[model samples]
Each structure stands twice: as C-alpha cells, then as structure tokens.
Target: MATCAEEVSKTKLVVAAIDFGTTYSGYAFAFQKDYSSDHHSLRIYGIMSKNGCSQKAPTCVLFNPQGKFDSFGYDAENRYAELTLTNEHQDWYYFRRFKMMLYNNPNITWHSILKDDKGKSMNAIKVFSAIISYLRQETLRNINERVANVGIKENEINWVLTVPAIWSDQAKQFMREAAKKAGIHSDQLDIALEPEAASIYCKHISVSRRERQETHGAEGVGLEAMCPGTKYLVLDAGGGTIDITVQRVQENGTLHQVYMANGGDWGGTKVDEAYEAFLEELVGQNIWEAFKAKYMDSYIDIFREFETKKRTISPDIENRITFTVPPVLRDVYEEMKNSPLSTTQGHHRNRKLIWKGDRLRVDVTEAKKLFETTCALIVAHVERILDKEETAGTSDILMVGGFSESPMLSNAIKERFGHTKRVIIPEEAGLSVLKGAVLFGFDTRVVSLRVMKHTYGIQSSSLFRKNLDPDITKTMVKGKLYCEDRFSKHVKKGQSVRIDEETQTIDYHPLDDREEMAVKVYITDKYDPEYCDTELCSYIGQLLVCLPMDVPTSDRGVKVNMKFGGTELSVRATVMATNQTTHAEFRLLE
Candidate 1:
C-alpha cells in the first residue's frame, strides 16, 4: 500500500473552499495562522434565502435573454420567480438541481449540454463555470470586505472544491475545468472528496464525545478522541448522492481508508422525487403537468416548501403534514379541469389528501411514505458496507451533509444500527462538508490513504493468443498477429494507495508509425478485466504521448507513470530517447 504524505503549497496564506452542492452551495475560508489555535477562525459565508440568511443558498443560476450571466443562488431564484410572474421567463434561463446532470450522466464531456427549467439547453461547462465564478467572486469579496484588512491576492489563496466521493473522474475533471474557466488556477486548486472532507471536519470535533459515550458506551468516543486504530464510517448524505466511506485513524493522526466510498442517487432529492410523484398521483397527471408549465413560480414555491418540511418531518409525528399550497395551483387546476382540485378523479378516491383553501394537508402516514424508499436505500447500503470484511471493526457511524439533518434519516439509522454502532449526527451537519473542505485545503494529507474503487488500466497492443484472444481483436503488426484493445492494468480494484504514490512505470512502444501515441485510459469494475471493449469496462480519457519523429518506429518508446491515489488520476510520460518528460492531460470531450 502506498503511504506517502501529501502537503499543500506553503506559499498559500489562506485556504478557501466551495461546497458546490446539488441542492445548496456555500463557501468557507480560514487563514493558515488561525488553523491550529482558533477553532472559530473558519468563516462560512451566509447567502440570502427565502427564510432569510443561511450558510448555503439553493444551488441555482440564471442567464438573461441575451445569453449573459444575471444572478445566482437565492437571488437568481427570486429574480426568475419574478420573471415567471410577468411571463418574461420564456427566454431567460434558470437552472436548479443541475448538479445531478453530472451524477446521472454516464458520458460527461466539456461540451456536454445542460437543460434549463423550460427545457432550453446550454453548454454544461458554461453553466457550471458561471456558478463557480459567482462563488469565487463572492468569496473573494467576503475575504476582502469582512475577513482581511488588505485585499488577498488570488494566487495567495488555496482554492478547494468538494465533490462526492462516489463521483467519476470525468465529473471531477469537469469541475476542475469549470473552476479554471471561473478563474481559479490549476496549481492553486484542490478537489476534496465530500465524505473525506466531512470525516476530517469530524475528526477535530470534541463536543460530540459525551453524546457518543452516553449513546453507545465508552467505546464510542468522539472522532476527535478516536484511538490510533479506531475505525468509523462516514455517511455523507447530500442532496444528490449518499456518499459513504469507512475510515481508520492512523497513529500519526492521519486517516486511512478502510473501504472505498460508495452510494447512489438515493438522497434528499429522492424524497422530493417521491413527493412530486405523489402530487401527480393526487392531481391528474395532465393537470399537474399543466400546473408546472403555466405556474412555474408556484411550482418552485411548492418545492421550496417541501425542502423545508423534509427536514422537520419525523416518523413519530401524529398530525397531518400541512403544506401551504399557493393559490395559483388551485386556480390553475380549476381553470384547466373546469372543476375544483378536490373533485379530481384521483383525489375523489383518496381521502388522505385534504384540500382546504390554499392549504394542502397530507396524512402524516403518506408524508412519511415519501421518505421510506430513500431512507431504506441509505440504511441498506450502510448495512452492506458494514458487513464487508474491511469495515468489520468500524463501530461509529458519523453522519454529515445537508440530508443527514433529516430526522427521518437520523432516526432510521439509529433504529437500525444503534444496538451495534454509535450513530453520530454532528451539529450543523450540513456545513460539515463546507467547513471540512477548508481544512483539507490547509492540509491535503489529512486523508493519508484511499482504496481504489475500480481497476484502472491502459489499452495497449499485445501478442495475440488463439484461445485467449478473440478473433475480432486480431490485427497484423509487422507480419506478427497482435491483439488490439488489451487492458494493461496499473492498479487493481480495492488496492490501497497514498496521495503521493505513483504506479510502477510501464514502458510502451508505438503500435503504428504515428508520431504521437494515444495512451488510452480505461477503468473496470472487474478486478482483472481482459479487453478494454468489454461490457464492464469504461473508457475514461486518453493522453497523447508525443514520440520523436527522428527515431524509427521500432526505437520509439514511452514510459508511462500513473497515479490514482488522489481524487483524480494523473499521468506522466517520459520519452526514452531524448529523456523529455510530459504530463498527460486526460481529455474527456475531444
């Protein structure tokens, strides 16, 4: 296992982190001097929400009709809502919950397109870049106006962006590209995995120790007090993804990965999806669709209300879940159906949905049902991770992220794992990622090790074997038969790796007389994949290895060195003849 320690650039005087979440987003920063002594040195920016000020505003952006950036966050939301009221939003682009585009997409490229609220499409990179740029400016403004006496130079600040641990390299790279477009230099930025950052933030928190001891006995010391070999699980349930990772504390006060992070799209947004489905069922699907189309402002309001209500909902609540239904919904429903919403076909059969002037009271049982599927998936996934051999010693469950604040989810986890492990929901669970990312920016080595989630390799030409290689992969190479698309694995799945460790150098020769070699990178779920074109294998990106044209094809060689220990994979290639070294830029889109 690779165990080299990693360090951030010492020239950086301050660390700033942007937690670009699916449902909400925020930024935090702390100076290097305040990192050790002052726990309250970290300053989290508060954005304006409908409820007033919050640590995070909704993750959203808006563009004017001229295709120029307008506003972001709650400001964008309020502006777009006003536009919708005046029927002026048709040409204006407003996007919300767009981070899911990266999660749901299998092929994310620089040119990937994102659709706005009205199904209008814009370049995905542009959309992401706009949000990141807004955050960057806001953070800099905060530091200049409130935190620092003198203006901080962009180069003097280390920028960190938090991504879900389960995200694909393409997604991570996409964020990097967006950050670059947003004016953050590649040398100054770091990608901190969501669960890993949360774990680091929890590591310094001592207030939860008493609660842990009282809840799960003496063995359940807080993460701050964890012994050298103590193992804990981090469940980062965000709006878009439930990222879970098992961590083991090392003797040096660093953390090692017990298991790779894993989870799915079953998050807080899943509950939103379920609620929308329920609404569609209660009101006729066509009517509901019409309502969303014509009453965009009201539709947004409904979900904003749902977002607030989702956090407070509990399994023990007896009273009905009262949602303040906007008057526009009722008006549109009656206008479209030529009758009151209560007399709808679906509502007539279900007495659980009570409609009273602008107030839609849903049975508590029904409201709780919306959470069942998502909560079940999260609970089951954690159970499966705990059952794994690598995580056998883990006895503490550290919950963090915006969705972890849900009482329903908190209760479900405790009810299931309380007897076996201590379930900890740290204070301000939502800000853990934002705050932890700032800490990660200060010290990249906080997470000293990580487990590989996939077997990573390069596609190369190999000597064809009659039985082992398929006939389709056979090709003539200098009168000798060779197999194309062979997987040359550098790192196997489940291998432990350190942040600074590089894979063993693998030398390769040009398959053809081409001047440059395409070092095609591939990843697979299988431990030992044979062919790069297999169903389980995915083509991630490729690096162009430039070979000296003066050298003969037979003499051309490049030594490939790959590093998969960090959040992103990096490649370095050294030419054999000139001894010239070049780094590979994994091009995702073309």
Candidate 2:
C-alpha cells in the first residue's frame, strides 16, 4: 500500500502558487499522492511552511547607503540604524507602497528600499526583489532539499500568481514581466484573480454548519454547503487596497459573483502616512513658520526634535507629548514679540531655539479620523457590491481579504448583514487568496488565462451580421469569399488560442489586376462586405488569394494556407486551396 503521505500527495500538485500582493506576498504548494489500500485514488496534502509563517511572507525590503543590502524582514526592521542607508539620496532608498504607483503611473520604475542600521527607511527595488527572490529560493530549497517524500522533480514545480480583479491586463502583464525578472519560470507562471482565489481558498476551510462533510480535497467545491443560495458581501481590506466581491452559490459548488468593487488604497500604510503628515505639519510647518519668521536659522533640527517627542509618547487624551524648550524660548515668541527661540547651552558659534508641547497630540485625533475614513470607504464599497448583487439575484457574499482580519471592519460587516444572513471571514483571511491561488492553479482548464494580443488569435473578418438573414444565428458563413476561402482557428469568442506562427498567403497581383475581377479582402458579417461594421471589423492587414492565370478570380474560391507558431489549442484547423474546390481541416481550440 502507498504510504499515507503518498496518498495525500496524489491530489495536490507539489508546486507553489505565489500571491505577490502589493502590501504582502506569499506562496503555497500542495503535495498529493495515492493513499488507498483497496482502490488507488489520489489524496491531497496541504501546503507546509516553517514556524508561524503559514505560507505567507512580509513584502517589505531594506538596504544600506553604500548601495549594499542591509537586511530584510524582522532583522532589518530591528537593526535599521546600523545599516547607514542613503537617506540623503532622494531617488535611491525609501519604504513605501509602490504597487499603486505601478498601476497609476507609467513613469515610475521599482527602486528597492533602504534603511539605516536603525531601520528608518530607504528606496530600492533591491530590497523588495531580495525579499521576493529569497522567498522563492526558500521554496526551492525546501523542495530540492526537503521534498524527499514528495514524488516530483525540481523543475516540475509550477507557479500560479494571483493579482487584483480590478487590475488592467497591461498591469497584469507587467506583473508577469516582473516575475520573469525575479527568476520565476514562465511556463509555470499564471495569474489568478485575487477575489476568486480567496473565495476558492475560503471554501476549503468550511463555512456553514449544514454543509461540511463533503470535503473532497482542495478543489472540492462546497456545492453541498454553499449555505443554500445565501448571499455574501466581501469587505476585503488589505495593507494597500480593499476589494469587495458579491458571490452567489449555484446548484453546483461554484460561486458566481455579479458585482465586484473596491479601492481602499487607504490601508494600514495610509495610517502611517497620516501620522507622518501630522508630524511634518506641526513640527516642520508650524514651528518653521514661527522660526523662519523670526530670522533664526539655528533651529534647524526643529522637525527632528518634534519627531523624537512624538515617538516617545503614546496616545493620551491628557497630553501624551512633552519636550523641554531652550532658554532662548523667551527670545522667540515673546522675545521681539516676533516668532523666535534661544539656544539652550550655547556650545558652538550659536544655538537655536527649541520648543515642543502637545504638538504630536494635535494630529493624533486627526490621524485616527483618517484611518476611519479609509476603513469606512472600504466598507461602503463592499456594501454597494452587495446591493448590486442583490439586484442581480446574487444573494450570497463570501468576505475575504487582509482587512477582513480587522475586528473593527468585521463588526461593521456583521452589522451590515445582520438583518439578512451572515458573512464568512476565514481565520487566516489574507492567506485565503494565497490558498485559493493553489486551487486555481490546480484547476487550469476552467480558469484558463486571458491575455492581450499574445493569447488572442484575430480573425481577418468576423461575419457576425448578414444582410440576407437578420435572424440567422450563424451569420459568419453568409459572406463567401470571392477569390479564396481562408481557414482561421485557434481563436473564437470566449475561447483562448495562441498563434505559434502567423502567416498570410498574398494574392500578389491583386493591385496589378484590380480591373481583372480583383479580390478585395475586407472584413464583415454581412454577405455584402460594404454593409458590415467597417469601423470594427475593417481590414487591418490583408492577404490576397490568387487563382492560377488559367482560372478566373470570380470563379475561384482560392484556398489560402497560413500556419505560424506553436501554442495549445483544443482543436486546430487548416485551409488548403490550389485551383478549384476549397478544403479545410478544423479542430477545437479550447
């Protein structure tokens, strides 16, 4: 009999699906095997990881001023000061969300982040890339070094990448590009919609009481337990963006969502920004106005001083901030009845004024308000999706996202769906999508990839409409080719096909023979090419199918054969023509 581990590894593919999230990134790999003593059937073992790291990794990076990498994760965060990062370089090192920038702006290139040995902050893609690259290396290390029991070769591992549902195809392509640069294998690469991945992952953990026993491995749908046609609203709040998707359970376990919405760019990072702005405003602006107005340049460290005081104290209603003022304080505001400050000890050529009190506290309340505002925006958007789903007859919502981890947000969801049914939030909310990415990767047939020009096979002229029959469902055949019949495969509506090699056989003498019953290669749905939607199905490029000199163009349905490149397809088709009858070979391209 196969070992239990072998059995578990049967259903699960021993590969990792990386969720390169904007705020956080993580990977999950499943190990499957055959474990039945009587009947040999595959069993699925879940993803394994080290320590408290359950298949997820922090997405922060750090480097030093010497352009040398300092450290990453907890290490850099702790000993930031020792790193001596180049904080002076405006373009070099910084720690901030670049994902939004990637989408919103085309000019911004990813530069790694850096921080001093104290770990303040820096700019560099090296830090981010290092963190990402290291995690990838760890995955390989565990597989090659520790995947002893798993029956898979090192190169066999496939990787599925998940991205936001609202992301543009161009943006997703860029992600794919970054992954390529990161050394992730291209064939192993795939992108899953984050919401869908989370939904799939959440389904595995179990949601309701009535439906639980039918757990048939990772891809097993909770069809039996999908809460029987209940509605759910996903209020996904994360470190960077918040997304909301409303899903409805069909007779089968699949979730069909009608509405998808979200944009909480104001996540945890926003809170930090709000706090920083508060400090920058009070100490930098307010104090500087008073100092600069008095012509005292000695107080250069005014902003830094305010930062120190703010950090030393915690939030307190009774005044959490306090810093001693320099003796020159009397010389400043009260000195010439103009803004000013005096030095404390007067050690050098001159000392400037220093004053601090309750400045940090002034922004605390405002910061909290900003945080709440971002959270509220996320919640409101989720509610809107739910409302739209209800209109579309989609009554169930499966809540998933990093922000769903927030108790504050969770309560809001419970209250929103209180009168109705309820919302389902996974225990490891953020990781749900990471897990779902695996599920999505495991099932590539149904969830095939959709790409721009690369994955698309364009038909020269789609005959969607015909003048002869307004109601004829198949309007494509109405327009017959006068010169030649060309075969187009590897492309169709809602179908995926790639052109391994794209080629066109030209009617070389069409221009020369324009008056000799010339062939006009035009795109259209109507039998009369002139009546088609020329703007949409117009001729982008054309190839003329020339009949032999002995045959007339009007009488010949010249068959043109074009073949290019090698890509997967459900069915393949070929068109062949010589002098007379048109011949074609067709296959389904899934």
Candidate 3:
C-alpha cells in the first residue's frame, strides 16, 4: 500500500511551449495531474494565459489611454471600436505588422520601434517585454488558479520557444537575446523548429491511445510515422513569410537530409495590403490620396478601422465608422460629403467623420482574387518540387504554421492536389508546432526533421550585370558563413544536392608569380559564374594563403594536400609555385 506522503514525490515539473511567430505568438503547458477516480493523467495540455480560453495568442500589442493596455486578446478585441476613436489630445497609437519594419530600417532600435503612428518615441521592446512578462506571470497565475495548479513556482517551470523553420541562425540568435532581455529564463529556454513542432500535435498519441476515433475523409487524415528516412515538406505560410522545408525524419528529435526549405517574404499581410488597395479603389484613389495627404496617421487609422469592420460585415451591406482626426483632413471630408456615394449617417464629435459613406466594399471572392498572385506562386513552387523527376516516392506534404489556417488557402490546395499524394493540414494547425516543441524538448520519441545550410557566393565579376536579374545560386559550403563552412556542406540556391553531408578537403596555391600562395575557395554548384550568377548568398571571410617564404623556390607548379571532414575526401591541387617546404602543417584551427 502506498502512503499519502509518498504520492507527493510523484509530480514533476510543468513544460511550456512558446510559438514566437512573426504575426502572432502563443504558449501551451503540459503536466501530469490528478483526475477523477484518484488517477493521474499524463500529458495534460492547456493553453497558458490569464484565462486559457484560446490555444493561440495574437502577437500584437497596443498602447491605451495614458499609455496603458486598453485591451489584450478578447479584452482588446471587444472594445476595438472604443479604442479606435481619438479624444481631446491627438495622441498616436500602434498596431500589428511591425516585425518586418525593423529589418527594413537600419536606424530602428528598441526605443525606435515603440513609437506610435506619429513617430512619437516609445519603447517597443519594453512593451513586448511587458506583454511577455505578463504572459510569464499569467502562466504562473493560471497554474496557481487551477484546482491542482498546485504549488509550482516560476523556477520549477520549463519552457521551449519555436521559430520559423526558415529562420536563420542570426534570427534565432536574436530571439535568444530578445527572450533574455524580456525577462524569460535562459534555463527555461529551448529552441525548436516550427514545422517539426506542429508535427508533434498533428501526430500526437491518439493512435497510440487506448481508444481512437475513425480518421479519414475528403479533408484527409494525417499519416503519423516516427521512423528513419521518412520524407516530408513543411509549407508554413504565416503572416509575414512563407517557409517551405523538405527533410527526412529521424528516429530522435534530430533532422536529416534537410535541403528544400525556402521562404518568400510575402504572405497574408501582403494580401491584406492589396485588400486595402482594392477598398481604396472602390472609394476612389483621388479621395483616398487626399485623405492621406491631409491626415497621414489619421488616414492609416481610418483604413485600419475600415478593415476591422470589413472582417465582421458582409461586403454587400453599407457600413459606417466614426472617428476624429486633425483638421487638415477637412477637405477630403467635404469631398466625401459631396460625393454621390450613399451617406447613411453623420456625426462630427471629435473633429472626425462619424458617417457611413458609399456602397464601397469587397466581397470574400474578390478578396481571394487579390491573393491570386501569392497563392498561385506558392502552389506552383510546391508542385514544381514535388513533381521533380527525382524523389518521386516522397511520402507526404505537411502544411503547418498560421497561414495554413486560411480556409481559402487550404481549399485551394485541396482543389489542386485532391488526388495526388496525401496533403495534410494538422489538426492543431496553429499551436501544433509549439506542442511539438514541448514533446521535442523532453527528448520524447519523435520523427526528426532535417534542413540544409547553404553558403552563397557571387561571381568575381558580373554578379549583377545590366538587363539581368541578380544571379542567386546555392553552393556547397558548410557551417556559418564566417565560421566552419569549409567543414560543412551547405547547399545554396540552385544546388539540388541530396539533404545529407560528408567531409572533403582540397588544396592549391599561387595565383601569381613569386606570390607562392594565392587561393580562392570557389565552392559553387555552377561551373560558370557568368551563367549561374545569383546574388551574393555568401563569401569567404578574408583569409590569405601565403607560403612560408623559407621553402625552396621553384618555377613549376607545386601540390598541396587538403582534407574534408564528413565526405572524408581529399584533394591535392597543383598551382603556380615559386617556393615550397618539403612538408608543412595545414589544419583547421580550434
């Protein structure tokens, strides 16, 4: 018989999964908890927040009255109307879609990003830190609020954060740094790839469960397999970027043969911009332009407000929004008033129009059409790779990330590939990766995914010649650009090499007379730099090859030996040599 005292030792720490996405972020936690009939259930998972109402959290933040939080999640969403209006003071505001802005602007800093729409100074990271800090606090709070939320302290908790599969090491490095700056514990931190994380939730232990439900139909059932050499593609179209990765699944939480991941900077937000453009066209460009010129920030504010209303109502119906703005916008206001468009209502409370004007609206069908360029290209790319003459037997296509949540997007996929190989949209489309990271962080049995590393280079000349698109090509280099690439085989742009790596070495010297040593490690997939000109993906750090000067002199070529690691291949290149030692040491540094 077990004593009650012994039962207290059975509980373990809870694990939190963080999905730090460009558009939004979310966290989930799991632990063993006591259940009905005095039994303990393992792998109890729940969304972490003040209230665990939703599994995903919007990664947007805003400043409220007096620079306070007017709303967060449903709280903020409910009062979107009240929050949209400006009062006595013409204070600025903030909203989503700033992630890419930081990259485009070189002057952007932690303080620089927090500025309101008016360019007023504020601390963006500080606000993000506050939100994340509150999240961390609320996780502990929610854990405490639960029946057995138990007595878990912050120190006892473990967490893992997931990033886009296409995120560069620099991005991950930035995240690690930012996570720390935001007060998140490094010890609690673990990094996992986005698609791999989603696979965890998609292929959860349901089949392994004692009882399972029938899984199949027109929507398609996910084929869950955690074995060696299982190949899959992760089509992650999110708010800001589209990340596509093709890799072989390993037995453990490791990836192999991961070469086929690429991303397009365009995503849903681009479509949203196009949508705004369409609405502007419906309202007349001149009118919209006038509004923009007179009231730049207010123009953006009004557009955002229109977008909010668009989300809720039918495009056929007339709708109105009321908000105040700078007085300079009065000209545009008069034009809108005089226009032939229907004026459903009017009120001038805060130096703004409180009127519903015109029958201008966009139907969902038209909205989807606006996304044609984006959707078609994404589909075409995926199809092109999948239909490659090689690897015809590849297993399946796994669609993960936030963009896959789009009903129109998925429908387009289903319409296109209904009969082909399996197309799976994981059940937990959004939070799947975060959950997968939780399981991955614990070293649990999982199908490992692999992605390749690529080093890019440009031709010594003509990298960007006139009438030519910048040549972008992938090369076989290993490791980080300035680090260990020589030891690693990374395939940049056009290199369709298999997703694995082996080591190799080559040696050569002396490009000029009396120089004794001049070598450029031209590692590339293209034989001719002219034809295969890609933009400079990468280049060698300044490394000069020079002879020992004490070596014997010669007028003929000399041979130098080099070795590559994984491939274990070696080569001796004969080059112009004026001097050489019978033997010399040449090895990679520590």
State in Å the error of residue 243, model 2.
Answer: 2.0
Off by over 4 Å in 3: 1-12, 32-55, 63-84, 88-93, 101-116, 120-128, 147-149, 205-229, 250-257, 285-337, 342-365, 387-391, 444-449, 456-590
Of 1 and 3, which scores higher on lDDT?
1
Per-residue CA lDDT of model 2 for 46-141, tens digit only, reads: 343333433344454445456665454434333432322322333223342456644454332344333532345544344445555666766676
Ranked by TM-score, the better of candidates 1 and 2 is: 1
Runs in model 2 deviating more than 4 A are: 1-13, 34-56, 63-71, 76-80, 85-95, 106-131, 148-152, 208-224, 260-264, 285-368, 389-396, 445-590
lDDT of 1 by residue, 1-590 (tens): 11111244456777888999999998888877677657544444433234643568899899999889999987898888888777888999999998988888989886799999889999999999999999999888877875566777887888898899998888888898899899988888889999999988878773365465655678656445667898999999999999999999999989999799899998799899998988777667888888877777788888888888888899889998888777777777788788866632234455467777778887788889999999999999999999999999898999999899898999999999989887888888888898888878878887888999999998999899999899999999889999987999999999999877889898898877877787778899899898999889998888677777887776688888877878877777887877788545567554
Question: Who wins the lDDT comparison?
Answer: 1
Overall lDDT per candidate, in order of appearance = 0.83, 0.45, 0.49
Model 3 CA lDDT for position 396: 65
Better of 2 and 3 by lDDT: 3
Per-candidate alpha-carbon RMSD to the true structure = 3.3, 12.7, 11.9
- TM-score for all predictions? 0.93, 0.56, 0.61
Model 3 poorest ten-residue lDDT run = 1-10
Best-first order by TM-score: 1, 3, 2
Error of 2 at 277 (Å): 2.7
